[model samples]
Target: MPAPPPHSAGIPASRRAQIGAGLSDSLGVGLGIFPLGIALGVLVVQAGLPWWVSPALAIGVFAGSVELLLVGMLAAATPLVTIAVTVLAVNFRHVFYALSFPITRVRPGLPRAYSVYAMVDEAYATYALMPAEKLSSARMVTGQLAMQLYWVGGGLLGVWVAGALPAPIEGFEFALVALFIVMTLDALRSKREVPSALLAGLAAAVALIAFPQQALLAALIMFTAGLALRYAVTRGAAHA
Candidate 1:
């Protein structure tokens, strides 16, 4: 497919549409992340943290789970060194993402570095929904940056909203859970990818059970195992 409009570089519509769609599409993943964001805001307010601090963390750190974890550590009066180390451990997957990212493909300079920083999992997933040719590295950077803005916007909004809410939102946080389950079911409606999905799910479950505390390690092991299984299947098919 050819490239999208110049204005639609990273996205596919007007600036308004770009922002709207980014916010809309991210609702599901945002839901999955919403509870955590709210919780982070609540904690920050309770801790008497400066308002600027939450936005800074959301922008600078940009990882949902890691931020939540860091807030938890802070709540416990954990040492800053320990909190920082734990944050690094939780986010080590980004190192792998950086290594695998098309370093040579993306343009060199501030844009590329900024893009790498903004490339969160939800943005990656959204990009995967687009065609490859339309997904220029520069466009990916643009899209990723847009998505980060949405994330930060949501978190900042949540911080203020959480402070004013009459009571906790409770189980409403499962909205994303339901959406993802639907998306998974929709994807699985076709029988072709079922085997791979099953294999990956089983591998992930086993890894999670075996490595409870090291989520990043478990995910890596599961991903490697799944890839190996795919490779073996392909080889067997070639011989057959």
Candidate 2:
């Protein structure tokens, strides 16, 4: 068979289409991410950090909530050991996310590496609900790249806005909480995983009460154990 013709831009037509579709898929998520990125930038400036720190975090960390937390920690001059532990505790969930992410669809080499590196929560959620047949390396990578662009662009814009403002804004830090709440609500609506949600809440409450100093780490551990036990029982019942 003859090879497919190239797009006017010199890329293969099919490749171009895949890239376009990926960008289109990212549009909705980008809308949400952009504002949060802006918030991060504003927070950085308000915290008295250099304007460049916003894009640096966006690129280096790429974890929204963690970046926000880091801003506060950096401003407070948090100890290195504590910061390291907190970052690990906060991002440990990504280890689980990797287990189910469709990384096999991507080609090996730099493409696969980039796909793995860019597998943020938004990308994971987007792919989890996507039909398996529709997945492709180009689409996944392009979508991730587009989301990052939104974040970087928003950060720059926000820096400009913050510089123009007369005074620092209060309550901008709440954007992190607001984003998570929206994500949680959306997940509930889509999967109706009420039991899992309830378990998470219980774990958080217990951890807060019992291990206040280590609440985040303790809650994550408890939640993971609860999920494992639930799965084992459910599987055994099915077999029985």
Candidate 3:
């Protein structure tokens, strides 16, 4: 008889299927992530940082937008406190992401810790839209691992590519903005999310006008409050 299929050796078919689905789900987001990772690596090198910084940020920081910002900050020799605050402001949205992320599905221990550590935007968005019954620890962790691999691998490649270039590439910094725009557009695809998007725009405009010095933090606070109020009203109406 022929050798048994891979899944039949030890792993259950259901688990193997879940792992496959997870990796499959990561592909679409990985396309965007990999390119952005390349941009980040190129940025680190062009900023006069060591090549190792590329993969360092990819593996250590692992937050794309924050990593991009860190490159410029580190190049300018920004103060540690300033860097810390900026990172907190930029990544504070992750706190909100955690509210709805199905992290509890992951088993406790190293697996759960890794899942939490790797909970990037792409993973959050993917899990948010997935049906509950279809979710499993294997799928969620596998998908996140795949996305991170893409980012890490892309960063390494970018470092090499940047080294070969005779001159630095301009506008790699815009990659972070582009990534957010794509995410916003994807989120807005649902009709129900339109109101929230509008609220975010309004918050951003008001913050820019009234708190230009702290626009990002201000906008996040305003948008979060708006979401909370909207939720309360909707809940009340439902109960009424």
- The model with the greatest lDDT is 3
Residue-level lDDT of model 2, residues 54-147, one tens digit each, is: 9999999887678888888889777676677778877888899888999988889998898888888889988867887888889999999899
Off by over 4 Å in 2: 1-6, 177-240
Cα shift from native, residue 177, model 2 (Å): 4.3
Tell me the TM-score of each prediction against the true structure: 0.55, 0.76, 0.73
Q: After superposition, how far is residue 172 of candidate 2 from its true place, in Å?
A: 2.5
Candidate with top TM-score is: 2
Better candidate number, 2 or 3, judged by TM-score:
2
lDDT by residue (1-240, candidate 1, tens digit) is: 998457545544554454564455556666655555655566565555655666778887887666655554555577666566656655766776665555444567986777677767776566555655444555556556656665566567767976787875665434435544676788698997787678757766876788766543456556666868788988999999
Q: How close is candidate 3 to the true structure, as a TM-score?
A: 0.73
Residue 209 lDDT (model 2): 100
Model 1 poorest 10 in a row by lDDT: 171-180
Estimate the lDDT of model 2: 0.85
Per residue, candidate 3 scores C-alpha lDDT tens digits across 1-240 of 998677666889999899999999999999989988888888888889999998899999987688988988899887676677778877888888888999889989988999999988899999977889989999999999999999999988889889999988787667667767987999999999999999999999999999886666678789888999999999999999
Candidates, ranked, lDDT: 3, 2, 1
